[model samples]
Target: MLMILLAIASACAYGVADFLGGAATRKAKVFRVVAISAPASLAIEGLLLPVLGARWEAGSLGWGAASGAASAFAFALLYQALSIGPMAVMAPITALVSAALPVVVGLAEGDRLSATEIAGIPVAACAILLVTVKRSAGVGRVRPKAVAVAVLAGAAIATQLIMLNQAPHDSGVAPLIVGRAVSSLIVLNAAIAVRRRIDPGRPNLGLAAGAGCLDSLANLCFLLSARHGLLSVSAVIVALYPAATIVLARAVLKERISRAQWLGLGMAALGVTLLALG
Candidate 1:
């Protein structure tokens, strides 16, 4: 139960970071944002190492690094998708794909859920879909490219979850920190090769860096939760991040949300509650 709560908190933190990251990307190059943000995150997480006193193991370090690489890919794709497309179509799709993957993996591993939890899945799905709906459009209309990128992002996200879950439980947060650092370096190098320049003068560097710090914290919480709970349940709870993003959009961006989104938010909350109970 405690783990589940931690997972929910992770989701909240991730959602906020995502929202801020996305917003930051709007005014800056995606690669630049990533390059600056990654180091910023590493610094923040490094500071927490002593306080958290997490164990360190070679295997866990490798897995954490792998997860970090996957996360870098996911965020890069997500930022690219949002750069050219509508958030209403892309965000929810990515979130759903990422959330569903761990559940599928858990099912394959024979993890069973209670009746209430089973019922909550579709409700949560529907709610997520509803929240993605923009006030400008009615049901059944979405941009295809945005959807594609979102799906790819989700796949990367799922990979992160799977790798993180596979890491040795006793291995402290070092693995995570190392993983993130390696992933960031990989993405940074890739971005440099592609763009031929590393420009850190992006308008929202501070915001992106701040978001990265939150993201690092979220990852720490998630790793802790995964160590203590069912992977599927923990993943689903953490996936409720879209709810936080939607709320942030409405509040910070002053974007008008539709009635359906509100209803979806309610359903998502209910689904998360059921998941917790299970």
Candidate 2:
């Protein structure tokens, strides 16, 4: 059950980190925000590595580095989406898609879930469509480009899980170290390409660094969670991260989601409940 707790903790931390990242984007370019945040996350992960008494094999480092590349791409997309759209809607859409892909892979790999769990798949799918319906000037609408990116972002998000889950059981924290290092390099390169300063401006510093730390911690929680539980189950719980971002939107941004979004949220909850039971 410790895995369950860690999964939930990962979800919560990710939610808050997404919220903070979105807020930081308002003050700086997304690339700049991501660039600064990556190192903060790396610092935390580095500190925790020894404290956790982790060790890894050479092969695991190679594989773990792949996860880093995948996650770096996914996070770039996620931060990009969060910077442009309503975080309340975007967060859930990204998470649901991320969760669904792994479950599909699990099924393909011969893992089975109960019938009730299977039913949740459709419900979650509907929710993804419903949640992306955005509003502008009192009109409800959806942007195809943003919607498209959101879906792609979800797929990218799933890669992080799929790759990390494949880490050699005895790999210790090697995958995490390699993964985060790769992500940092990606963000740094992106920032350079855009001529964006890697350091956050004074106003953006706190939010940027905080987001990075939380994100790093979230990844740690998920990795530890996977060590104790099924990846499918851990992914499901962690996918609930949107809940935290939604709360932050309402409280911090004073944003109200569309009615359709609320309904979608309900459906997502139903889906998660079923997944949990399954």
Candidate 3:
């Protein structure tokens, strides 16, 4: 229950961060947005360093760096796909793919679920797709090439999550700090490649920094949750973040609420209940 709550909290944090990131992207280039946000997050982590209360051993740092590399690659691919493909398709693909591998790993290790829990897996995954579903037709086609890139991005996200989960219990939040640092560096390189300013302009810069702080906090929540409970459950709960994103859209963006999104929300609640019970 504690782990489930933690993962849900992580999702809330992530959902808000994503909303902010998306808003920032509309104002600036993806790399620039990420570059500013990632470091802003790192700065907060640096401040929290003294109070994290864990031994920062080499092993933890190594795992954190590895996770960050995979995450950076994932972010790059995701941003590329978002730029090229229609978001309705790309968002669901990336979210579902990112959540898929951890479930596979957990099940393969012989974690048993009750009937409802088994049902919840597909239920939750489907909800993600529904939340990302566009009301009207989009311009981009789901080409084989685009699908391939989306899959790769998803795989990268999965790798990052699984690797980050490997951090030893005593490692504390150091993994977040190191992993976030590496990710920030990757974003900087991406900004350089695109010839975009690393630091965004005033309001955008402020927004990115705020979003970064939340993103870092979300990662920490998931990291702590994974260390506390089954990765399968943790992943599923965190994956519900799309629902949160949709709710935020309804509130902040004043986006029209679709019947499908409403149904998706209901399904998500059902899925969460089953998973929590199981």
Candidate 4:
């Protein structure tokens, strides 16, 4: 029950961070937004480390670094895929792959699933697709290149989660600190490399920083949840993040939520409940 609550909290945090980051990107260059966000994430992780009582061992640091690198690649590819493809299609595919891969890895690593988990996973996956379903009007044929990139991005995201889960249970939040630090450096370097391409005018610094802080919190929750529960369950619950995103969009931006999305939200709730019960 505790793990389920933590995973749900992580999903909510991730959804909010994604919304903020997406908003920031609309007004600023992607790299610039990432520059602010990544460092902010690092800062939050640093602040949380001492409170979390991290051991900071080399093994944990190595796993964290690996996760960070994968995370950077995942973000880049996801953005590229979104830029080239219909988000309605790309987002669902990426979310499904990212969520499914972690479950597969966890099972392969000898994690057993309860009957409820077996049922919940598919329900959560269907909810993910439904929640991300946007009306892609006038969009041309689906680009194969975009699909490929989205798949790769999802795989990278799965790798990041798996690597973070591999960190020693005793390491506390050290993995998150190291991961955020490495990702921050990478994002900063990317920003510098394309400085000329970034917008020169004022950017949405507040949104970017807020996104980063929320993302750090989400990571911490996911780490704790995974350590305490089955990765299969935690990953699936986290993948339901798009439901929260849609809710926020409706409440804050007054965006219209489709009937399908409303159904998806209900399904997502049901899925999480089943996972929790399992």
- Model number with the top lDDT: 4
What C-alpha RMSD separates each model from the true structure?
Answer: 2.7, 3.5, 2.0, 1.0
lDDT of each: 0.81, 0.77, 0.82, 0.89
TM-score of 3: 0.93
Per-residue lDDT over 67-155 for candidate 1, one digit per residue giving the tens place of the 0 to 100 score: 98898788779777776677667777887898899989978877788887788777777776787666445335556777788899999
- The clash numbers for all candidates, in the given order, read 3, 0, 0, 0
Per residue, candidate 4 scores C-alpha lDDT tens digits across 167-260 of 9999988888888888778878887988988767555999999999999999999989999998888988988888888899899999999999
Error of 4 at 208 (Å): 1.0
List the candidate numbers ranked by TM-score, top first.
Answer: 4, 3, 1, 2
Candidate 1 vs candidate 3, TM-score winner: 3
Winner on TM-score (2 vs 3): 3
Model with the higher lDDT, candidate 2 or 4: 4
True lDDT of residue 23, candidate 4: 90
lDDT of 3 by residue, 89-133 (tens): 777888898889989987886667778778888888887777767
TM-scores, each model vs. reference: 0.88, 0.82, 0.93, 0.98
Off by over 4 Å in 1: 80-86, 135-149, 196-201
Task: Write model 2 residue lDDT over 66-180, tens digit each, in one string.
Answer: 8889887897787677666675557667867898888777667666667876776667666555554565463245566667777779999888888887887677777888898
